[model samples]
Target: MAAIELRNIVKVFSDKRRGRDLLTLDNINLDIEANDFVCLLGPSGCGKSTLLNIIAGFEQATSGRTLVDGKQVERPGSDRGVVFQQPTLMPWLTAIDNIAFHLKLKGVAKAERYDRAMESIDLVGLRGFEHHHPSEMSGGMNQRVGIARALLMNPSVILMDEPFAALDAQTKLEMQEELVAIWQKRRSTIVFVTHSVDEALVLGNKIVVMTKRPGRIREAVNFDLPRPRDITSPEFNDAKRHILSLIREESTRLAQAS
Candidate 1:
């Protein structure tokens, strides 16, 4: 069975001032297979994040259906984990503590929580800094903690919304490499949302490009480029050029409509 299935999904929001409802997602349908790293890439305001949120069960669609693991998604559940653009860790909690907070909330024994948290900490390459608080760490380190926290849940799916967007260029590259490695090792289904063409190409095995609001699927480009991909290589540039052309065409269409 598909890991996730979205059939004819639609989302609408009320515009009180205008006295009209605005459609955000329009008849969207997608099937994400297990262990697939899919990136939703598009221009700003394309409702990519909204689509991710619906799948995460943070929001419900106005029409159609969403299923994860062949089960209907009603509300937020432990089966899925989310990592946001900012590392929303508690400032006072140590890295290990922050990663294990969910377990603690569930009344897990301290020893077991620490043990599990340690594994994720090492997974994100923050073993030695486990005792450091969020304030003591760099932006990248805090984001690593966030990723570890989510991974520690062992959720079937991980939803990331531009998690590395706030980091410096070098740090972003490092996090991206580490994230891909973790995904390879963990082999969990991931739906990542991003605006960068290169970022989408570098990370996703499948890139789902969306049209501007009211968002619609433009294409689902399969990208199986080898890891540690040579960005300057012809194959890489060729893929980038293809996506660029798609974006350009989308822009031209919108321009003409306006």
Candidate 2:
């Protein structure tokens, strides 16, 4: 059985100002198997984030159903961890404390919480900086804290919404490598949402492309390229070319409609 399933899902948003409803996602059907790294790739405003939110139970679908681990998703739980675009950490809390916040909420003792959080802290390579507050860290460092916090949950699936979009190119590449390493060791299912084709290609084992507004699945491509993928390789270029063509066609259609 798939670790996560979205069966004929549809999401409609009420546009109060326009006095009409807007369909954000339409007839979306997806099945994510265990330990698979899936990236939702599309143009901005294509409802990629919305779909992730639905799976995370932060939002409800207008129709159809969402299931995680064979159970319907009704609300957010520790079984599924989410990392947003922003770090969203408490400004006053130190890195270790921020990572341990979830454990604290569950009424776990302070000593145990700190101990468990330390593992994730080291995993993300923020050992010596654990005592630093968010205000004292770089954007990339704070984002690490966010990822570490999620990792400490030991969730079956991790949902990310453009978590590295704010980082510089070099930092982004480093984080991608670290994320890949972590996934390799932990073998957790990851549903990552990003607008960048290159980002999706670098991180995901499978890429699901979506169409513009009122999003629908355009294609689900399986990538079997060897790890530490060389972006300039012939196979990589071929896959990129195919995906680019699909995205170009979608953009042209949207442009003409407008």
Candidate 3:
């Protein structure tokens, strides 16, 4: 059964200055199966992030419906955990405290929160740096804290919006492997948004490609590549070629329209 579903979703923004209505997403429909790793891939301004936001209940769609676990998504909850592009941890809090912030909000005791948060810290390989503040950590470490914080919620669905886009290439690769390991062990539903085709192929079991602004689904491709995917392999290149062709064609079509 589908863990998350978006049916005939539409989002429109009023351009008050231009005295017109701008359509951002049009009739988006998607079904994300339980424990599936899906990626929303497209060029910038394609509403990929907007779709993620809608699923997270951070924004409302102008029309249609979003359902998670057979219930309507009216607002954000602990059941849906979001890791934004930026690591928005509280600078005042240490790594363990930041990971436990949600638990604290629910009035969990400090000792209990710390204990629970510590488990996640170790899961993300941050055991040695539990007391470090955001300022003292590197960008990658801070992002790890963000992931740990989200995992502490034990949410059924994890939403990531280009969470590693800001890191260096080596760091991004390391994080991707670590994330895959975590997902394999936990088996939670993940909907990740990224502009990179390679990243999508590496991380997603299913990839949904979107068109340029006034975005719509171009296609949904399923992949069953072996774990610890070799980027240099022929099968990997074949998938990459197919997706690259789709993106290139879309870009050309948009160029001609303009």
The models' CA-based lDDT, in order, is 0.94, 0.95, 0.95
**Candidate 1, residue 144: how far the Cα is off, in Å:** 0.5
TM-score of candidate 1 relative to the true fold: 0.97
Per-residue lDDT for 1-258 in model 3, tens only? 599999999999899999999899999999999999999999899999999999999999999999999999999999999998999999999999999999999999999999889899999999999999999999999999999999999999999999999999999999999999999999999999999999999999999999988999999999889999999999999989999998999999989999
Considering only N, C-alpha and C atoms within 3 Å, which residue pairs clash in candidate 2?
none
Q: Give the TM-score of candidate 3.
A: 0.98
- How do the candidates rank by lDDT, highest first? 2, 3, 1
Model 2, runs deviating above 4 Å: 256-258
Where does the lowest 10-residue lDDT sum fall in candidate 1? 76-85
Q: For model 2, what is the alpha-carbon lDDT of residue 179?
A: 99
Q: Kindly report which residue stretches of model 1 are placed more than 4 angstroms away from their true locations once superposed.
A: none
Which RMSD does model 3 reach against the true structure?
A: 0.9
Query: In candidate 2, residue 74 scores what lDDT?
Result: 98
